[model samples]
Target: MYRFRPRVLVDVSNIDMSTSMLGYPISAPIMIAPTAMHKLAHPKGEIATAKAAAACNTIMIVSFMSTCTIEEVASSCNAVRFLQIYVYKRRDVTAQIVKRAEKAGFKAIVLTVDVPRLGRREADIKNKMISPQLKNFEGLVSTEVRPNEGSGVEAFASSAFDASLSWKDIEWLRSITKLPILVKGLLTREDALKAVEAGVDGIVVSNHGARQLDYSPATITVLEEVVHAVKGRIPVLLDGGVRRGTDVFKALALGAQAVLIGRPIVYGLAAKGEDGVKKVIDMLKNEFEITMALSGCPTIDDVTRNHVRTENERIKSML
Candidate 1:
């Protein structure tokens, strides 16, 4: 569902994929999205992931449910990192986590907004998977449930996520931290406008990896809508189903300041630890650069809306 108009007369030898987010300079626009319990993927867990991100000179968003503590992950590498938080039913717990992240040098807080209740992941249910103890919250709080029937992740989310979460909490989060805040899990133009009005530093267009709600529009499909509603006032990022460099290019053209890769990083870590992660990043970087050159973009700035067309646009043209 991607269409690009190629230009043959452009320089292909030099292309820059570097871009800034939240005033931090990253080597490329690609970044690691927050995935919980990385220890399931590798022995070193988030520590290995952190080291890889540092080596690649990109950002990594550490999940609040990470297998490693914020301090442990921060100590593993000096990579620019963000912390993804699910506001717990307990406000104090949320505040403490934010404080720990800020103190540990996280540059931003990615507040996931879509999950008030854990979505039914049928695969996890069928596999009878149990989430590992969240290292970040270990000893600070207990999410232990009384022998749940489904995955521990579902149980934990059900117990911890504040079902009463509302827009006013955004201001409360802003008050508690000096770090920039990005509201993740928004997919609509109306919500995008609301996020901007709520004074978030950025917005992430996501559908909880389409695990939260079935039949939701793909992130790429709604990226332009959110971007348009934001009106250039704040950065809009996208996550979900980005496995190829062409996918990255498509998201960027539609107005994602950058895209986040979730499953690929996990797959890489599970396959070969830190080196695998670096390899995955390197592959994406190379392919994205090639995409840039082939599409007539010599730099990230050169990649604009005109560089690509959506399925709707193509169909309209035919009509």
Candidate 2:
């Protein structure tokens, strides 16, 4: 899905992956995507992930549905963290959580705009999976599964997520906090423009891990379109199917400020808890550094559009 033009004559030493996102300096452009129920992977859960992120000097976006509370995750370590929020059916609930995130020192509010309803995750359905007790809402709200629902998560999402959520809510969220609001789940140039018009601080081009819409285009395919639409108005981020350093390099070349990894971190946590998570992050960083070197990019800024080609471009050249 990607092609790179390497510069063998260029210096390969001193490659720097350090970059800043929303005013926070990170050691690398790689960040941990907000995935739910870390407890499902390890007993330490988000607490362990937070520690790993801090150790790596990267950002960690905490899920609203996290097994650990915002406060607990914040206090876990010194990592720069953002909170991913899903608007609940109750406006008050959304506001309360935003306030809590701000108070807990979360750097941004990653407002997920994709899921008005839960997606048909057949795997979860076959397993009859139930979500862990959403610890963020532990004392504040209680969500129970209705009888005969395929999974507890589905039932909870159906009852809790506000289907009527719209562009106007961006203004509502702005009125509540001064923290940067990054809108996630945009896959089109049209919606990307709308997000900028709505005054979001950033945009995350994602497909909810391809779990929401069955036939949606891959995030990488649409990333450049969304980036061109925004035209550097805000930081454009991508999160989906980024499994390698080359993937991250490809994303940056196409115009993403950074990329996020979800399932890999989960797998790492399950394998070795905090240490495992740290290892995963370290491996990605090392691989990306190697990629940058091979591609003749001594710095993150050097990884530009000229470094890579897309399938369409490749086909055009051959023709």
Candidate 3:
């Protein structure tokens, strides 16, 4: 679906894919994206995912709805962790989570700016999917109760999540914690520029995996626009549909500092728990390394926008 401009006869005998996020060094630029209810995927849940991140030497944005507690995941391993959160109607609860993440040694707070309300997922509607008992909110919010009618997840999120969340609320989020704030879910350059203006540390170009709205542009398609807007002011990351090393390569060529993987992580966890997750990460890392070598890139910085050519560009060039 995409073409890479590989330069031959350039020595890439020792390719390096190592990079850092918010000053935290990682073995590779690949990170584990937050997906709710990892427990449903594996018995170990976020703990297992955290361990995989440790083994792979990368970051994992633990979901706010993780089955395992923050302290439990933190003590499980020395993996670099960040917490992904949605603003709750109860601002106190959101503030409490920020405090807990900091206390538990999380390196950053990834504020997912989308999902003001749950999207209408048809599969969930058909299955009446019951979300796992959210352990983190056990005492803080009632999770034992499940709606007998429709999707319990939709009901719970509607009642708990702050639908009124807006760009101005970034200031309120900043007031709560000192951790670096990376706003996720920007699909436009305007919003990316606004995020930079708001003083957020980084931006993640995403559309909540395109489940939030119909006909939304893919995150990768809009990555260059967002990156062009930011103009290297901060790191730009992408997460969604990244299944291989080439996907990571294409993203980097488009200006993504790194990419976070979502479904692949859960797939691995569902298959073999911690080891499965590691296999997924290792596969991507190895693939990315090979891709870099073939492309004459010896390091992360060597990956540039010119390295890739999208189909649209190809057609235009022919014309």
Candidate 4:
């Protein structure tokens, strides 16, 4: 017989995880990251996730490559929606998406700028995984619209990214939508400042979930530099490896106005459905509030530099 040691309780006393994005107040600092196929995860896909976000009073960014069309998802969601757009071979095809998103009442257009070409996905490649062809584009293309010939999702993605697009294209995107514009895939302080100078409304400090560049720095690593570079000229948001409440707390402490969630939400969607997605969002909010409280943060402001010691410790260890 052995004596049991008493467990030490962690203190999470006063926490405030409430935050906002693009002038919309959200219950927490989390947004669903846009992934291409929702149908593969669940039958309802974007529609289910949108409903889930609405139920939790959170925001969600719908993908351009979503299984359902913009109107379909927008009709089901009470949550604020942002459209994530990628460049297509033709300007008209890209413009059509923006117009449709605007007509469907999306509040902003997030132009993803890093993928001029699709990066190889080994898991998808190995399994010979094929994304289901979108019903929406069935009659829109030519007589022979090839779907699975290239590789997998990567091949499909390669067909969409426009290498010809430049800063001029960004200006054109701004001209097309009355909604605010946010440039995603910005990884450097210089590019962040350039976006501000380009007259965009916000910058999302992302690396396309580390799917694009294999050796790229994590979104959290360069967040401070981007935030400080922007100097409050525009709101800065982050995404990638942010699954915990402490992750959200750390982001705010590092100066991100809010954070975006990607793969975890997809995982939840895969496991359950709309309900699973909602549960994931709620779990994040609850954890964020708890982390804030335990860290002695009563409000968003209370999660300051002093509250994040691990980051500092890591930096010191690097030196």
lDDT scores of the candidates, listed in order: 0.90, 0.92, 0.91, 0.81
TM-score to native of every candidate shown: 0.97, 0.97, 0.97, 0.89
User: For candidate 3, lDDT tens digit of each residue in 168-231?
Assistant: 9999999989999999999998999899999999998988878888989988888899999999
lDDT of 4 by residue, 1-319 (tens): 1111111253445455667888898888888877877898999989999999888878889987788988999899678999898878877777877898889899899989888887777776777667676754555532122445445667666665687877767788877778899989999999998899899999999999887889999988899899999999999999888988778878888889888898989998999999899888888888888766666667786666655655447568589
Question: Which sections of candidate 2 miss by over 4 Å?
Answer: none
Worst 10 residues of 2 by lDDT: 140-149
Give stretches of model 1 more than 4 Å off: 146-148, 315-319
Backbone clash total for model 2 is: 0
Candidate with maximal lDDT? 2
**Candidate 1 lDDT, tens digit per residue, 1-319?**
7789767798868788999998889888999999988998999999999999999999999998888899999998899999999998888899998999999999999999999898899987777677666777776677655345767667777877899999999989999999999999999988998899899999999998899998999999899999999989999999999998998989999999999999999999999999999999999998998999999898898888888876888789899
Q: How would the candidate models be sorted by TM-score, starting from the highest?
A: 2, 3, 1, 4
Off by over 4 Å in 4: 1-15, 142-150, 310-319
Better of 2 and 4 by lDDT: 2
TM-score of 3: 0.97
